[model samples]
Target chain A: MQIPSPYDMIAIGGSAGSLPVLAELLEQLPVSIDCTMMIIVHRLKNVPSDLDRLLSLKAPITEPEDKQPVLSRRIYLAPQNYHLLIETDGTFALDYSEPLHYSRPSIDVSFASVAAAYGPRALGILLSGASKDGAAGMQQIIAAGGTGIVQDPASALFDTMPLAALELCPEAQPMSITDMVHFLTELKMSAEHDQ
Target chain B: MIKEISNEELETLVSLIHRQYGYDFSDYARSSLKRRFQRFMGYAYIGGVNELSDRLLQDATFFERMAQFITVNVTEMFRDPLFYKTLKDLVLPRLATYPTIKIWHAGCATGEEVFSMIILLQEAGLLERCRIYATDLNAVSLLKAEKALIPLKCMKDYTQNYLQAGGMEDFSSYYTADDEHAVIHSALRRNIVFFQHNLVTDQVFNEFQLICCRNVFIYFNRQLQDRVLRLFYDSLAPLGYLALGLKESMMFSEESIRFEAVSAVHKIFRRKS
Candidate 1:
């Protein structure tokens, strides 16, 4: 089946083994893409580093600000020690009250929030990571009538995250990062066609 | 990989809980229950569900412990600050037109969201005209909500959220700090009611202008999400609002087309005419 296009937002979740894969995926995304992107990568809480600087090498990046309006073609990273959630009016919010599975910037929280916000209009992609963090959130995305995509375990740097998501959401499509990017670009094109 | 529990054993456990005890787990999503059971087993130092079941039957303490395990009690105050901020900036103004308002916090765990809503309403000058109903499946969390006492350490984080969500007053003014706990202002609590209500089996008891159920559906399956969404749709008055957790949505449900998105990212929806 041709997946729906014009996704309101794209939510990507990853962890330990995500950097290289994230870099590859970001390189594939065109600067002219017109959808908001929210990325959740598990990280150490107190160790201050610039993910924006890191991601900027591959794509334009922005950190979600409280109540700031979301704009297209910008990559938004979940801040350290906070669960970044998308707001209804197309802005971003941060919650730092507690940690899930001993990790802040949890993939589950971000994926789950986006699943709720965009429903079928949301696209959830799980990349390489350690642990089963994004599994439940992928299930949430599917349960909310959204599409769930995972990097093919065979190609993933660490198969744990994609495997977990596949285990939780059996219908999730498995693709290499290149195929996934092509698929999303085609989706955007098709959505524009229909519109 | 987590050891897979047999379906028969899972069914038997659910049946026993329903027959011997008043609680029902039969309708809960199987995967979620399994994950929680595994976590409970690990936490209680039991080998698996069979041993955990035996302990639950033999020891009341174990049953209580299992209760905590089964319920997804994860929550934080002003969880999606922008959602609350949107309610304050966008929705409350319309709600203020009404002389009186009734809001429900369905699946409210430990009352943080309820208290947060009260604080929002108080700041919006709507508290005097509002009566809030806060319900949750867990009684322990409800009791905590009733006490209105949360750890003082949590105050700093919550205060930050309050400010980020666009608070007009000092965050410290909402509570009084004791040794380790902060007592929420009684004035905010006065118009609030706390009760236990299970979303799976319970029916809507009142019409509401706004109903907030955040992060509670991640523990439920698709059927249950649809069921609960239908319940919320039925519970809402015409043009009323429904807010869900960042991960929860009403897509594919019968009510999906019946409500228009007020804030899609915040999962806020307004009832259609």
Candidate 2:
């Protein structure tokens, strides 16, 4: 049997200076992106956050419960203090495991699990962060034949994370926040056109 | 390498755990449980659910370790210091009117919060009248709690948390630190009782003036959370305090009506008379 088009999931990971860029990116994203999108950012455990409400203005975002189905064409933000994983059946898995790289909602955990669940159909994006947490997971995504993208270090407020990602996936295309939004918009248009 | 566990495989393991050990994990959130099992599998180098089941059946020692792994939770001393401050400023004062106080720290992994509570009681001069029951499903963690030794590395952070929680005295005074570890002062350990108590399979043995079961219910499904909340409610004395993790609340359960929020932002609730 022939496999379907490999563009089922888009996962974005960031930390430190992600909010403004994320807002800009979300603002530019069209309603008909044609795939499931998930965002993971480092957050302090036990602290209440208003991220879901803030992001919901752009697109209806769900802070999915454990075992909830990960549906297509929707945006999901990982709940604070929970390591979000993508199950093989395309559902969300929440883990309260010890913090990885001092982060409970570690970008690494989400990226690796996304790669495992969606394989070549996934696209992993790494943005600004002060740590090298997501580098290995980004590499895993690339190794699994999924596309890996990173914000250009020069444009990122905290360059360590993007630089680390670049070190792991040397061939990954780097884009500024504006360029990333433009590139994704083009990708979505072409994907819709293909249908 | 860890492989994805199929639905059938997951059901088999959950049933096996229930049948063989009488531990009820069936009601726990399925995705979280699967992730935890997968984590254990990765650590133990067990390839698949069948092999995990086989190893668990053959080796009792492995089962003991597995049980520890299942119940182990990541915790920090004086986590969300403001919550501790609320306990000190509001909760503890109300409990002080009682002739004697009984506090239960349910699922007290590694006993950090238990120690934090003891410190609060001690500083308030209420430690002598307080009887603390600290329990968890993991016996290994209970023993570690009994030891009351924290890594020296974490002491600084814990101290900062202590200060943020409004410590009147120097935070370092509560522990004796060497190069590698900080052992809580022996005096603070006097009123504490650590034991193995599985919330899923255990019954309430004592009425408590205050029950702190933070960060435990997030792992459970709604049904399990409701069940546990009811258990907590029954175990609490009239007008007693029930403290939950920041993310957890009784609002989602039928039990919410029976309790009033002492400080909703801090997740402190009191049983209504």
Candidate 3:
């Protein structure tokens, strides 16, 4: 199998049953990882206030800076009432102006931006979530020559987002959290080998 | 049967648009172009696509009305505030290093975004060093942009956006409110030059440190998007920044590989080596 290079950034989007899967994935990944990780989890505007704290249990979590430079190995979570975007200089931004897809922290907004900026260097991972938010974005990632991976719908806690992504891009890899971690580890190792 | 619009009808409509209007819908996504044109025909009280095509050839007034329907002119002041804020905080620092800056607001409809950038550059103390080229495909929209005014009711909402995007001073200070209109301050308008430039048929005119074309390309097909992205790529200085709408992506475009993500969440990219 031809493994893609180590990604500059990994953007994951999920909602509903994603908390456990995200926790599991973070726990398995090491802090020494070279890439930046960004996650957007859909929650009631008020309820997920402690998302930074929750994700920080496994990885260092920070609220994205408006136009701040992108830092590697840190996990950035989308703040409430803001859409997170990746800028060209490897920084993060938060927009609180309006909501797309009726959600402030829209999956499509973040994923599409990643596909645009990172192109083939982007890795998009879609997990269990409600609705079809990330479907169109995943297609964009694939079309941009980025690698796309989704949690298996059958294995997902909430199958909607994963299933929607699968429907949109049939060739996307569907893996369990353990397998996904292994895949990323191998990807990193292969990248180092090539270098 | 309802979907069966004859080839002759399609050909006639395409020819009418090219000849009479001098606007080309020939290369637009077929299904979406057809749907929009059909709706335009119905709204204008014309009899179907073929008749609408013929009427366009004869009546200049109908063509003017048709242009409005065909153009996607939706825009907002500081529509993506965080992106503007990023330009202020991150990109402006780099732009400040230069003695002069040229910024382009491509596809600037009605000038809300152009004025928004003007306000941002002013706040950053870069306005005096900057010259903004605000261009759009629709001449009607360009005229509106040149007016530099917005509805008074929208001021409250835009003010809120300005604050959230980290406005250091009062939003009211930037505009003068009279009756139902807010005239943008003359200081902010000094460096802005408004013109009509189509991304599809136009060539790059100047190199820019920052180019903002937000919420516009989502209406375009992939081919057009690629064409516009190339135009932007050619227009940007090396290591210059490109900011797009939240939903717009440079993926599938030739320029995608030539830029790096500065901020993934803000949809900001910088030209690469």
Candidate 4:
């Protein structure tokens, strides 16, 4: 039997035109995937967010508390304004520092921290957006020997984000929503076999 | 160069600061500290974490500069309007009865929120009786807070926030401005005692009727949060009020039992009498 994939975390970063894709991804993913799922989507800072409540319809999506445990089998969404950071010590941290790439919870910030924490043991996904925020982040993942994937530019509502990532990480895999669902299924099965 | 920092290197750096400068960052959230250290590296033109730590140990002034960078200072006047309004309507009247109203603004970075609090006290006619002690971990920030010079460009937004916080008078009356900045009127500064106090290592200095430490606990780890909760609980007089950041929860702390929620939505709690 092929060796089961030992991935423990899957980080997804997107901005404009990504929310619908997230909803679809959540609706399709299995009920019991045992990896820490982190999603960072750009949203207004001060406005109250229903994104968690909206996404929770598919699965139990949550916003992490500072120093919250990075337990697996849960979906963690970034809060509105604060940068969500992953700790190498198996926890999460929040920062209210200045915005980068015109964003508080910058894709680059979270992905850099994610890359630092998980290295090759993680998967990074970049989806539809109009900005250049996630490109450097995806490159960080690839440089750390992690798997980098992007939603195929053809399938993205806005191709700029995925295309930018591919430009930086030429070797990153590009997949459609169907392909991503299949990839996640195989990932889940691989984990089941490993355990 | 694209890689973010690791905890091991950061731990060494933090311990080095502790050993040499007596500035303890052991209880702070490591990820936030690591991010700040990375920015400090860029500012100082240092190459890596090992070198950063080496330079800090080798040069005391550089370490001070590094300390300045590590402390997050994203603050604005009346940053959260509703918090102030709620205090004005709900918390202040209860506090006004005290013979000498002692209020502590813990981790009051740049004193914007402290200024807002003072405005509330003034409106309620409690400013004379209130003795406000505003403290921050960074001396540089404390100095800025003492001066109360806010950027002139931000006044429009601050004024809007003041209105939303139920201020009837013109917010501009609070400050006089230059081309670049607005220095808050000196009268408001009369009762405020500014000082440097480290929440991580410092012991409780005084008891107060209200301790406003919003958005500060977000930088602390769970253990440190618990310890600071104990400090706040000890420093608060019986039935004294504690206001925390909207996201902060003291649920797991031993002091949690000692504080009853005054307003869970506002993150206000009162010490058990």
Largest DockQ belongs to which candidate?
4
Residue A149 in candidate 1, Cα distance off native in Å: 20
lDDT of each: 0.78, 0.83, 0.77, 0.85
- State the RMSD for candidate 3: 10.8
Point to the candidate with the largest TM-score. Answer: 4
Which one wins on lDDT? 4
Candidate 2 runs further than 4 Å off: A1-10, A16-20, A27-38, A43-94, A112-123, A135-148, A153-174, A184-195
- Order the candidates by DockQ, highest first: 4, 2, 1, 3
Q: What is candidate 1's lDDT per residue for B162-226, written digit by digit as tens?
A: 87788889989888999999999887799999998998889989999999887676555556777
Question: C-alpha displacement of A181 in model 1, angstroms?
Answer: 16
lDDT string for model 3 (A115-141, tens) is: 767888888999998788888778878
Residue by residue across B169-218, what tens digits does model 3's lDDT show? Answer: 88898888899899998867988999989787889899999898876665
By lDDT, the candidates rank as 4, 2, 1, 3
Docking class of 2: acceptable
Model 1 spans > 4 angstroms off: A1-21, A25-40, A43-101, A104-195, B1-9
Residue pairs with backbone overlap in model 1? A87-B266, A88-B263, A88-B266, A112-B247, A113-B246, A113-B247
The TM-score obtained by model 2 is 0.83
Estimate the TM-score for candidate 1: 0.66
> Candidates 2 and 3: which is better by DockQ?
2
Count of clashes, each model:
6, 0, 23, 0
lDDT of 2: 0.83
Candidate 1 docking quality: incorrect, acceptable, medium or high: incorrect
